[model samples]
Structures are given as C-alpha cells and as structure tokens.
Target: MFAGAQVSLYPMADGFVGVILESLSALDPYRDQLRIETDDISTLIVGPPEVLFPALRDLYCAASASGHHLVLRTTLSRGCPGEPDDPICDTSCLANPSEPLAQRQANALETLRLAPDMGQVADAQFSLYVMGNGDHMAEIMGCIDFLKQSGTFYKSKHFCTRLTGDAGAVFATLQQAFCQFGPANGHVTIDLTVSANSPSKR
Candidate 1:
C-alpha cells in the first residue's frame, strides 16, 4: 500500500532527470503503478509492488548513467513509506575511499601500464588528475579508465607510468580525463603531475 524510498545522487549532472528515466527503463517494466517524485535532494516513490520495483531500478540506472555513485533503499508498509534509505547505510552501494591515497594512485598507474604499446613511444609515467567533485572513488575510477582507454600509452608493471612518457602525450591524457568529468569539474579542481628522468643532451 505504501513505502519509503531514499535516493541520493552524487556529483549531480545536467539532464539528471533524464538519466533517472533511462535507468528506470532498463528495469522491470511493471512499475507503472508507482507514483514517483524527486527534488534536487532525493527521489520518493510510492505505490504497490507492481510500481515500486521498476521505479527503484530506474533510480539506480539513472545515477549510474550520470557517472554518480548512488544508493537506494525502500522501507515497506501498509499505508505510508518513509524517506529513502541513506547511501551510507548500505556499504556495497556506497562509494568508498577507505583505501590509502598511495594505493589508489598505484592502482591508477598500474592500469595505464597494461595497455597496448604505441609504436616506438613508451608510456613512462601516468599523470592522473582525480578530477570532479569530492567523490573520491568515482574520480579514482575515472582516472583509471582514462589511463587504460586513451591511446597515449601501454601498460608496464616494472616502472612507473608517471616517470617515462612523452610530455605531450601525458598532458593530452590529463586533458581528456578533465573533459569527461562533467559537472564534478565545477566545485573541484584538477591536478596532474608526472616526472621523467633527465635524458642525454642532443
């Protein structure tokens, strides 16, 4: 008869409502019975089983599409449901930054090292800018993806990717990640650093 749902979105984006709809569309379609409402803060949905499941799925999907790490929880009842669950209550759904920064940085570099080679060029050091808002986990993941997907370099485990690349290539990679950051780029700042040993003079 009634239920409470809580949806929290991080690193909010433009057309966020659309992202939510797209996400919902991917889930069980019987959710038409539900009545859903969302504000800048969260989304609240109510109705029977036929309605709730689909609504919840959309909430999950939209957050995912917008590059937001999200969490949703439903409290069921006979008449009325309370607010949606807090993202912190569910560890699995929440983004975590419990790992040390050094570990995160190392993981980013390791991802860069595993890519295919670029002809004669060697990808030396990876300069990753954990761009976007304060959602550290998402930004870390973003940096990792940029390192691996961009055509600038290949993967190597022995040496640091940040220490060996062409200067231009490294900057290009940093620029790409910054661009993908979207809204997160507003409140937060970007930083990228790389170091290469001195080469012999011409």
Candidate 2:
C-alpha cells in the first residue's frame, strides 16, 4: 500500500526543516519506501502506508513541541489492477493543490463530526516573528499588507489573521501568505492554527 501526504510547518523555516529532517531520519528504518520533496512553504512525503503514518504522527509531534503548527492531508493509493502505481508520484493528486496549507487543513477538518449543529467555517490564527532584521515589526506589517492586498486573507488583524470561508479559500490564502514572506530578510518564525466550528457554536 502507498500513501502520500502534504504538511504545513509553522514557525521558523529552519526550525521546521530541522524537525522534519530529524523525524524522517528517525522513521527511515521503518519506511519500506520513502521520498521527500520540499520548497520554501511546504513538504511532501510519499511512501508505504505503514511507514508514512508513523512518520506523519512523529512529524506532527515534533513540530507541535517546537511550536510549529501544521496541517496534513493524506491519500491512500488504490493501485490499478495488474499495475502497481508508482510508490512515489507527483504532488498534483493532492486535493486542492492550489490552496494554502491552512485552508486545506480547515477544509479537511470540516468533514469531521466535531459538532453536530455548529456551522463549519475556515478559521486561522498565526503569528510571524522575524529576527535579525531591525524594524522587524514594520517589515512584518509590510508583509501582512502584501497579503491583504493580494486578497489572500478574508480578514487580517495585526498578526493574527482570521479566515471565514470554505476550506479551499482558507488554504489558498495561507499558502499565498507563506510565499509572500520569502523576500523578507532575517530569520522568520510562524505559528499557525487552522480549525473549523459549527456556525451555531461560534
């Protein structure tokens, strides 16, 4: 069996990278097949179902402890008859490849039975801390403004942006925001949370 997943790492990029590399190395022994690809904003993993689950779980733990919030989406491969699909394939199969990690997570979460009566809305809370850059606060605000102008966030606050919409909308927004931070100088840290709640409950 094969599985693929995408995860969003919160906090400093270096911290997130460190956590993932560490977890993957620790889980390597159990992985019958493993392949990882990462860019600035996210990471993708493809491997045997058994190995991927543990790796995913461990990655989550490490990121959480390091104060890096994450959003994960997984798919179980049902290989075609007489032909086993590639153990690791392209990332296009991921649901809403265009959406941001946060939105994707919120959308997936809304499918759960968290509360029977509450309406489901995509929610996000995140903070960014930039080190080594003087006037860090201003730069961060500039980044925030770029995100807002780009319409990546539904409603943006000082540092915590709240998105209320379907999962796709939320995810797209967050991913866009992550990309926006690329040009800024200094070390960047992000703390993110994506969730859903019934309208009745919120």
Give one digit per residue, the lDDT tens place, for model 2 in 22-84: 644544554555677667665666664334444544454444444344443332222213334
Q: Which ten-residue region of model 2 has the weakest summed lDDT?
A: 111-120
Highest lDDT model number: 2
Angstrom error at residue 155, model 2? 3.8
| Sequence-dependent TM-score of model 2 | 0.37
List per-prediction Cα lDDT, in the order shown. Answer: 0.39, 0.45
lDDT per residue (tens digit) for residues 8-125 in model 1: 4332446655655565554445444555566767555555322343344344434444544332333322222233533222212111255544444454354445433222222234
Which ranges of candidate 2 are over 4 A from the true structure?
Answer: 1-121, 150-159, 182-185, 199-202
Q: How many clashes show up in model 1? A: 19
Candidate 2: how many backbone clashes?
9
Count of steric clashes across candidates, in order: 19, 9
Regions of model 1 farther than 4 Å from truth: 11-32, 66-68, 73-202
